[model samples]
Target: MEFKNVSVVKEANVYFDGKVTSRTVVFESGEKKTLGFMLEGDYKFNTDAEETMEILGGDMSVQLPGESEYTLYKKGESYVVPANASFEMTVDKYVDYCCSYKK
Candidate 1:
């Protein structure tokens, strides 16, 4: 997938001591997205807006809110996170992903 006519922020959103990083992309239609990658590690993310995370490459095991087990998602797969909720992810090696926010 690709985005056209979008503005990308130079400054990255760095997390977990830079284990996870992303750049914000603003579209002409006022939609926002972040393209990033995760290194081998476990992570937990909290969202203010609802988010759809698509795996671009590699894979991850995710535990959504209130879920006890992590579900594996490979490249080309996606998952949704509810607003004001949180999710956990386990990346074996690396994962390339795009996250779109719905406000």
Candidate 2:
């Protein structure tokens, strides 16, 4: 099964590694109901999807343009980004995760 980028996706300066290995995951695909995964070191997170959920892993801070801002998602935690709002993220270590949408 292939995961389509049903939503606009993009990433910058994203990396992943644990002690002795590493990889780069900057992906985007949208045409069907989908899930996107990415590994980022320290970068900005932006989205325009009606709702976006972060699933899997990461220890980063989420920045909203105004009123609300925070970092979320890791192992069993997740978050939904508000529509029409832009956000950003930063991390100390490599972060891994998947995004899902109903577009």
Candidate 3:
């Protein structure tokens, strides 16, 4: 997907020792999103706002809040994480994703 008339943060939001990295993108309406990629590994992330994660490329196994097991999400798929919740992800190799936060 392409973003138009938006501002992107130069510095990345790096996590898991750089295994996961994302760049913040700010829209004209003050909506914010992160475009990022994850290398092969397991990761846990906590959310302050509700988030919709769209898989841009590759795939991931995600365990959402209160979920007992991981569910596979492939390219062109998306998942939501509730506000103030945490989730886990397992990336097989590399997964490209876009995360949009609900205000």
Candidate 4:
């Protein structure tokens, strides 16, 4: 039982090591743009509205702009991407736990 790949929810033969992971966004927070990210790496984006992402698995770091500071997130960890937060980070095997609006 893993949420990594929904395609074969019950099979464990193929290397599900991010072999194929996707999301079906059924309902979004119409108020702002939302997205689900997976893999190992930081995302670069500048938005008028704040974006949120949850660290479902793997190690990751959050680096905010204008500061030489960073926040670290581990497995089962969650954090919010502040509005106007021009930040960049490196994700070490990071997967996103996003809107459960799936098929």
Compute each candidate's TM-score over C-alphas. Answer: 0.96, 0.50, 0.98, 0.52
Evaluate residue 25 in candidate 3 and report its C-alpha lDDT on the 0 to 100 scale: 99
**Per-residue lDDT for 1-103 in model 3, tens only?**
5899999999999998999999999999999999999999999999999999999999999999999999999999999999999899999999999999998
Number of the candidate with higher lDDT, 1 or 3: 3
Q: Quick one: best lDDT, which candidate?
A: 3
RMSD of each: 0.8, 7.2, 0.6, 7.9
* Strongest candidate by TM-score: 3
Q: Where is the poorest 10-residue window by lDDT in model 3?
A: 1-10
Candidate 4: misplaced stretches above 4 Å? 1-35, 99-103
In model 3, state the lDDT of residue 67: 92
Candidate 3: which pairs clash?
none
Model 4 worst lDDT run, 10 consecutive residues? 5-14
> For every model in order, what is the number of clashing pairs?
0, 3, 0, 0
Clashing pairs in 2: 5-29, 5-30, 62-70
- What's the TM for model 2? 0.50
